[model samples]
Target: MPDLWQNICLHILLTCPIFVNVWSRHDHLYMGLDHRHHHHLHYEKDNDLSLWINEMQVKMFSGFSMKIFAIDNGKVSPHIKDPNFSMYLPTIPSEVSYVNFTWKSGAKKYDYHFDRLQSLDENILKPPSISIKTKGRVPRNPKEFSVFLPCSGNVSGVAMFSIGLLIQTRKGKPLPGTPLRLTLRKECAHRGVYDRASLTASQGPDPECDKKCANNGWCNHEKICQCPEGYMGQYCTQALCYPQCQNGGNCTAPAICSCPKGYQGRHCEG
Candidate 1:
């Protein structure tokens, strides 16, 4: 009877599925079997949905890059080649909205972000902008004034004084490091008095003063020196005596003549 019972048990084991756990401490036996079919059955229903969500998340965080341009006087001008990843126009005029931009990536093309017209909150990604305006008058002469001379002592106080007068008369502000041209006039005499002519003084003259004399009859503000009569030039070096002292009995000095018997003043006036 025992052998028969053992044989029946073996038959039962072969007929029914057998399960055995390599390691188990519980009285109930732990089962191990191929669960691939059950796993597939549970996953099939939600596979499409999960894949779609992953794809959407990837596209959402892809970020955006853009370029900015300026539209002025009916002409479109490229202002910024490529701006930040995303651009928002805070205070752009409505007319400027008409300005077109072509977004390109691979073989795709899109218009301005406004065309997409996503959710209002999503579309409004940038903040409002602020603008400021400032204005000032244009200056007539931007360069500074300079006084150059052959020598530092060449420019006399009188020359500087005269230059001050000229500047004052013209209401001009003198600046430093500016170039000035000193030109002697043809007619040296004005109002019956010989007005020793001097040019606008500059910072420093080239070659410096070779001769020892004040520039013109004017004394330099820095170096005040009286010009000797009849000796008139930038440095009182050139004798004013010229044109052979016309009608002179004897040419004593520049612009001066000593008359004979009947002659009187300069030019030997009879």
Candidate 2:
């Protein structure tokens, strides 16, 4: 009887490895749906996407060890060394609709540059061709690297940028880490256009007033509602200052009647 029990236990142990492997793959496939506990560095949630630089030995290519740093938000993270180095950018703020890569350095020697960077927007008909403008001055540090992205603009989407170096030897041989592919989280959004549903949406206006303003008007902290072109009123509900502009008066401003000849008072209602 003891031998029979031992044999059964051995059979269960042999099959457990296969079951665990299958379950792990299944869990990964559904990670997006249940990401509250997901801790993998490579697969973060969409709203909390992070950028990273994988490990690679720069000295292997140029025979000189090189350092790398990520500069963003007026702050620089810790520097990375050759081989087995990874730099993870901060979790993307919800207000940031998308990233922008406006410029790059034009230095010929020992300057930081991206070898592999591209937009993740699948809708983009053709990604913008990165123009290496020789007109710019040499970038002294990572701050003045000419990449002033992360702005609000008409275009919106995830701007993927792969970092690389330009090691120009006397022989002009090709360098390593030429283009590192970045698997960016795709998003269709323009720069500087914070999501309306986010807390940052009220950054420029009074929280309550912004939601109260109607008919293309924006509310300010002082409760002054700024109406759009061709509209006026405290809440932008009235078409004109006097709606009908009695006595031929015109609406020069919201709720402020502009009386015509011989007409006066708030609504030009002599």
Candidate 3:
């Protein structure tokens, strides 16, 4: 009773009824996996093994052939299931775009000085609407990125970050099931026992961009306008809206959806 093209791979499911997720201890980042629908072999399955990284490597488990261990601290125990996912998998995108995320806390301000943002091909990424902040900056080489809160005076704890992004096709159309949020938690140690990066500026704004920069964004060393949230382009002229305008919805500003008469909801999918 299988379809004409679904005969052989039917018996061979990606994961059996039960599965265990992989583990990580590398002090890099946190990522979340929004589940995708899988009706393989005509079975409604949500227990397939998820993917993760360890020691800066894309972990490859042939099947659900990994062991998952749990550690509880007070009321915090981590889980790896896509609990609230309800969408089909999208086709592969030709390009990936990461929105530069910056955070401001308390009275402390940070200026992340980097040469240029690199193009990363991460398997998972969050959307533009999600708040992805970071406490530190990898000024030289950025491998994995996440959101973090600024800690001061050797104050150490833990934080989670989701580097949201957009996936687009060759002709520049936003793919569906996108703006996927990836979260990773980092445990920080107290001072005198850890490595640290100078995230905050000891001085004032760069003279090159003090008065030249437009909008509320900062001017980096290269005199480029590091635009504020909900904006993009070299000069931050274009407002960004990921999963761009569906059902003829007009996106006048960042994440601001202008639905037509017959459609509603953000991105007008509802």
Candidate 4:
């Protein structure tokens, strides 16, 4: 009996390592033991017919990544990078819709399905703006994109203006440009014809204009408009008179002029 017991103990010890290894592998296969939690699925309920995703979460796996796609009425929306990304849905007759989430782990796949409530808001269904022309390659370096306005008439009473150009890639670290293009879009009117005005940016305006307007004036291609002290107007067309004169007195380009009891000059100094 002692010899038999000895033999049994030896057999058990020899198989212990093998059993442990098999159990570990099985756990990995069934419980994602070897895989990291790479992505998450989340949804929201709405009172209307359109289903919108209000939150999403995701993480990177050791050797894998994840993407999300939303399908509505049999049409697939664009793939979103994160589950938290919000989605706006179109109006539908039914208040509830179906959503499916497909998760891929290496060669393995998992799927989840849920019923999502849709709150169809007419305001949310309005199509995004497709009118802005965003063509041409975005500059690799600090390149200037400009719009030319032909006449001052086009700019007057403009109230607001904006233009957008698409950016393609970044070569080095990205620093936002002043007059950042993204924020400028909101200030622009949705639809309006603007008179052509040429826009260019450099260290300074044309060298000739710089030299011409050197003494506090603006040099145009054809002429220079010297702005007078305390006054700024088109071609010096108008004057800035402060402490405007009352009682029929004309204000000069800078100072207020009190005319004789009968006559009024721009500057009462007259």
Candidate 5:
């Protein structure tokens, strides 16, 4: 007979088939996160996920994305690649601790090899005086922003982003152990400014969509509703139709296609 501990582990593995957690728990290793990507969840049901010593590889089918932040101005940017891979936030996060990630996104592949976060250039960082002054004061509203990195994906090989930090001296000199460039990356969807998103999204309501989401949807940075499945329309008030209504038909309810006159099939094809 197996021991109680082994049985418990086996039970968990059997019950939680949708997700997995891989960890090392080392005290020294660190993985900094950008202000945009916080969730590790996905809609991929048929995919292979593996975690070896210090590397992670996921054969994803439905979604994948990543981002990098400018250390100096606190500006975040997305990593653009061919055939976009997007996903909504607000799901259970998978705990996959690895320094490197290989996203086998079918035809379009993305490989990320994240090194330890170290020093970056001083040109992009705020002055040391400002840093020293704002040491312990966490802002109610962080002044960081996210933008798309143009041409960042057009590299000879895998797009390289070195997300680094900088520690300056009193006289504005780059400290001893920092890099010459800054690379702070993230991967997320529905991260429109203001609305704040899932595990890794901002934490407050944006002013543009203030009092508009009505507890059913998330307002994106564009002041648009990023609704959940089954709901649609401005502020997510209308129901969603799967195969959308026909040429002139309207979606009257969830999965309900209101066909136009003379159209008589489920999706109005007949």
Candidate 6:
């Protein structure tokens, strides 16, 4: 009876189909297991999702040894061959932008690459600084912005890059180690400056519009200056009738000629 039971157990173990459901705890969404090489590989699921690893790849036989290993793969896609690349940052006169990055180099030198200029916000869109030409030839200023790390392949050094436009006119120098994150967003359908007008004709939080008028003038919905009683001109910077009454003439309306006893007509012209 013991021998018959042993044979029955052996037959069931060998003949019955085994179904294993494996859930991965790794950060990667898709992975592949090579049966012949006994290794695991990380696969990008964007372009080649159809060739992704199926449920059969993660299974393990009862007698097979399972090895756990992780590989750091930074390559985003197969088509882009460059692991390290150079980026030519845009130039603007007296304007400076910054980028925060990590650097790890065993080779003599490596470059930071950029595909194109993109922005996440359209209202804040400004032209790149690198494209602008300065009044004089700019001197070659090499900035020491990188933090050095001890010799370790696993460790990386953080660094900052400062893109200079106009150094003198800048509000202040940028703080080290801080970087501006760049992104690309869809273009806005409506052109020109964006402005939100309320029922009382007050300005809303539309970032594109700005109040550049001087004195008590208000910036209208079209971005034009709405001069107050005493102010005038495009930016409301000029006084309508200040000291304009030459030769002892009494000042009245803006740009209106108010002549003295001997003078007459506009500006008190004789």
On lDDT, the leading prediction is 2
lDDT of 6 by residue, 58-100 (tens): 1111111221111112112211111221121111101001111
Backbone steric clashes in candidate 5, count:
18
Q: For model 5, how does the per-residue alpha-carbon lDDT over 42-117 read when each residue is reduced to its tens digit?
A: 2223132111111111111111111111121221112111112112111111111012211122222112222233
For residues 1-270, write the lDDT of model 3, one tens digit per residue.
331112211222232222221234322222221123112312432122122222211111111222221111110112322432211112211111222332221122222222222212212211112112222321221222222122222444443334343333334543343333434433333435432211211112355654644557566554445555455434444554544557888767766679999898867877
- Backbone clashes in each candidate structure, one number apiece? 21, 9, 12, 23, 18, 19
Off by over 4 Å in 1: 1-211, 214-230, 238-244, 248-251, 259-264
The lDDT, on a scale of 0 to 1, for candidate 5 is 0.29
lDDT of 1 by residue, 177-219 (tens): 1111112111111213322232212122323344445534444
Instruction: Give the C-alpha lDDT of model 6.
Output: 0.26
C-alpha local distance difference test of each model: 0.24, 0.32, 0.32, 0.24, 0.29, 0.26
True-structure RMSD for candidate 6: 30.2
RMSD of every prediction: 45.7, 23.1, 20.3, 28.8, 18.1, 30.2
Candidate 2 vs candidate 3: the TM-score winner is: 3
Off by over 4 Å in 2: 1-91, 94-115, 124-143, 148-166, 173-183, 186-270
Estimate the TM-score for candidate 4: 0.20
Off by over 4 Å in 4: 1-177, 180-218, 222-229, 233-238, 242-245, 255-270
Candidate 3, run of 10 with poorest lDDT: 68-77
> Could you arrange the candidates by TM-score from highest to lowest?
3, 2, 5, 4, 1, 6
